[model samples]
Target chain A: MREITYREALREALFEEMRRDDRVFLMGEEVGHYDGAYKVSQGLLAEFGERRVIDTPIAEAGFAGIGIGAAMTGLRPIVEFMSWNFSFVAFDQIISNASKTYSMSGGKIKVPIVFRGPNGAAAQVAAQHSHTVEAFYAHIPGLWVANPSTPRDAKGLLKAAIRMDDPVVFLEGETLYNLKGEVPDASEDEIIPFGKARIAREGKDCTLIAWGAPFHTALAVADRLAKEAGIECDVIDPRTLRPIDETAILESVAKTNRCVIVHETWPYGGPGAEMVDLIQREAFDYLDAPVLRVGSLDVPMPYAKNLESLVLPTPERIETAIRRVTYREER
Target chain B: MSEVKVERWLDDYREMLLIRRFEEESARAYAQGKIGGFLHLYIGQESIAVAAATTIEKGDLVFQTYRDHGTALALGMTPEAAMAELFGKDTGCSRGLGGSMHYFDVENGFYGGWGIVGGHLALAAGAAFRSKYLGEDQVTLCFFGEGATNIGGFHEAMSLAGLWKLPAVFICENNQYAMGTPLSRTSPLSDLSVKAAGYGMVGDRFEGYDVDVVREHLKKAIDRARSGEGPSFLEIETYRFRGHSMSDPGKYRTAEELEERKKKDPILLILGKLRDAGVDEAKIEAIEDEVEERIEAALKHADEAPFPEESLLYETVTVEKF
Candidate 1:
């Protein structure tokens, strides 16, 4: 195993997949020459050449639709949005064209494309540039939404997203691009399957669920709770939100007898709300407390540093929810 | 007349007549409540799609807007499949999932019957991108109404097609209106093809009433695309004899205006051309009779076809759902 940055992991996945299949090409605003806005596609233009590494003008809807169209005709395109915030302009292409084309054409058309980029808040980027779009995309039936929390998962999940015969929305963590984690060597070819949850930290006291940037927060909070309050939490990260690993969450909840979902998305009708409903409905009788959720405040992300920090689900809020669910008192 | 000219005229006339009669029966089916949802017929604009079909090769792809029955029929979709799709039967081209507005037959190089006005143009550019990337000579034909030309997707698609030098021919079938809004009210310029200059693409505009003229113009564009000369914008001036959809009464235009446009009907124009080429009266009448019989058979097949099974509802959402 070798430690690599999440950004490096993603680039490796793209490089490997494009090499494996000639049909695979990367197209986006700054993917080529610019080496991607986040530099995730650095050196891709030189390695894959201009034909495979395509650069387009600042037109999200156009390129997104083009990716869907290319997928329909037998090309596997990895269309990158500068950020998930920009995907709204291309929402129709992703929702209407990519998602529905497969079923609309009665399986005659297969949109084997991946729309990937950083999602959720990154520092003080404000409301428009910082959007956690997993809920909106996951709500669509024909789409797969994968939120990778680590460098290893980023590489494995991205590879799987590209190879799968369906449309995938790969939500990367803007803040986690440089996060270092262990990834298998190139010859290993590790690919993670969807609909599976990774128990980041195992415990029996309470089930603490989160994903993306929030997953790292949950892990840190779980470690702190065990040391300071003796509240050992079963920290879980269900990477893919759409075909969620219900069995893992319910199984952990059935043992722990309580749960608290933490996420960077808004509280109102978000993935956290869906998780709460699922946990309460499936594991209701086993619960000692109501399944609670700690999510971003139900308001537009603020521009000020202090207000922006408060709007997102901070470690303090997640710790409070864990204590409440576990019935542990403050120190 | 030369035997080759007569044969070409007869073939073109039969294809145009088939589309006209198919659309006419679709209107009847809509009125009878057999076909639910919006039915946008291509009654007077048959020559554009038929001519396009004649101009492209087997590997060339075609994309069209919601008013796509004509394109589907012209691209060799069986009458039964198109009619059954409108009727919402399991035997339909899209297997009852896609109604009239989403007819698809990929095997025949017809990608789809996209409902969104200009949303599909970018997809067409993408298809052309794939061809260019693979070094294939396949040309992509994207058809849309003049209404679609005003949308953002239209500009974005055109800009990309032009910038990338994609093998795409953007055919704007300016049938005078975007739904009920006339071109005079919607667009500033009467010649929509002039918009191509902004994207650095060549432009052409011609009457769509004559099948031969439509074919020749489309062939020129298609040939340029095949030769890697980049995309072209083609404004095929035509008129829809029917309203925008079945629900439209078309009171926006006067009865006299409608009659005046009908005088240049594409089907009639092709029929007259066939007669002038010395095609026998018996041959023309037999073609008309055959088209009539085909429509009747399609209607019967659609009427008898079964609705999709309930299990099919859960299928095709993804290739393999987790």
Candidate 2:
């Protein structure tokens, strides 16, 4: 297995998919000569030419709808949003056209398009540019929401999303683009199926579940809990949100008898809330304590580094929640 | 002027008549509570749809706003399917899922109707992009009210169509009002074609009531698109005889204004042209009888059509297989 950066893995996935299928093309603002706003599409224009790797104006709604239309008429377009925060401008197109066309047209139309970009808070980037949209999109029935945390999952899930015969909202972690990890040198046919959970770390004392960037925080917290207090944990990353890997999550919860769901999104109606509800309903009788949730504060992200750090799901906060769930002594 | 063949002119006349009668029946159905949701009648604007449908070939796609029955009918969707869709029956074009606001007959190149004002314009441009990307000689006709021209999406879509030289004809049906908001109140300019100048595409305006004029101009625009020249913008000056939807009483306009606009009704204009071309009263009567019979058959079929099975409710939400 060769190690690669998450950004490079994404670029490879785009390159391989576009080469495999002529119907696959990329379009967004600055995707051509500019490579990409984040360089995820670097060198794509030179490889695929200007026709397939299109550079659009600063119009999300226009380009998104164009992608849907192209998909309807035999084209698999990969539309980049620069950031999920900017996806608001094109939300109507995603919800109305891309998501609903398959059902609205009575199965006559399928919008096989991918809307991908960086998501969640990045460093000091304030409220407007920082948003975790997995829950927002997962709420929609016709869309498949992919929140990939690692370089391996990012490449595999993106390739699957491009080939899937439905609209996919690929929410990549903004801070994880440069993170290095082992990405298999598999052929174009390799794809990590959706609705499968990956156990990042295995233990029996308690379950610490997270996805996207927060998965790293959960892992760090688990390591600290073990090293400092002799607490072992099961860290699970549910790769896809819509068709969630409920079996893996519930099995872990049932085994550990306690769970602490972690995420960087807001606390109210966030990914953690959905996981908590499922755990309480299915794994309630096996629980030693209530299923706890760890998420950002119930407010918009702040620009100040101190306030932003306070708002996000840090390792210390996750560790505190894990100890509380395991009934360990306070530090 | 080119001589309008009697048979082709009659076909257009009958097609327009079919739309008029179908909408009138739809209004009747709405009144009786047989149809639910927003029922937008294409009563007065029949000629634009007829001309647009007759001009474009089978491969060219058509996208329009909520007032889409006329376009669907003109594009050769069976009257039964359209009526059943309004009736929310399984036999409907959308299998009863899309109702009146959304109708799709993709096989015949009708991408569907959207209830959102200017949202479909971008989607239409996308379809046009597909044609250009694949090197297919197909054109797309997108219809929206003048009010939609004021929306931000309209600018985004039109700009991209111009920038990319997509094969799409952006037709603005300046039907005077958009859901009670007059074009004068919302639009910066009464002449919507001027907006096209900003996008660098050829802009034109015409009397929408005259089917011949609509056909002639639309043919040229469609030809231009198929020939890889680029998109064209047209503001078809028309009026909606009915209120915006079944709920509106249209009290904003005076009875006098309504009467004056009706005097130049598109159906009547086509009829007058046919009579002037020596189409005898017997021929007119025969066409009316045939249209009436078709409407009756559609109505009866729609009335008897079954409600979609409950099992189908969950289907079509996504592809059945990978």
Top-TM-score structure, candidate number:
1
- Kindly report which residue pairs in candidate 1 clash with one another: none
Best candidate, lDDT: 1
Q: Write the per-residue lDDT of candidate 1 for residues B44-150, one digit (tens) a residue.
A: 99989989998899999999998999999999999999999999999999999999999899999999999887999999999999999889999999999999988
Docking outcome class, model 2: medium
What are the TM-scores, per candidate, against the unseen true structure?
0.99, 0.98
User: For candidate 1, lDDT tens digit of each residue in A23-110?
Assistant: 9999998899989999999999998999999998999999999999999999999999999999999999999899999888877899
Model 1's number of clashes is 0
Give one digit per residue, the lDDT tens place, for model 2 in B43-158: 89999999998899879999988899999999999999999999999999999999998899987889888988889999999999999999898999999988888888899999
Candidate 1 CAPRI classification by DockQ: high
- lDDT per residue (tens digit) for residues A181-260 in model 2: 99988564569888899999999999999999989989998998889899999999999988889999999988999999
Candidates, DockQ: 0.85, 0.71
Candidate 2 Cα deviation (angstroms), residue B256: 0.4
DockQ of 2: 0.71
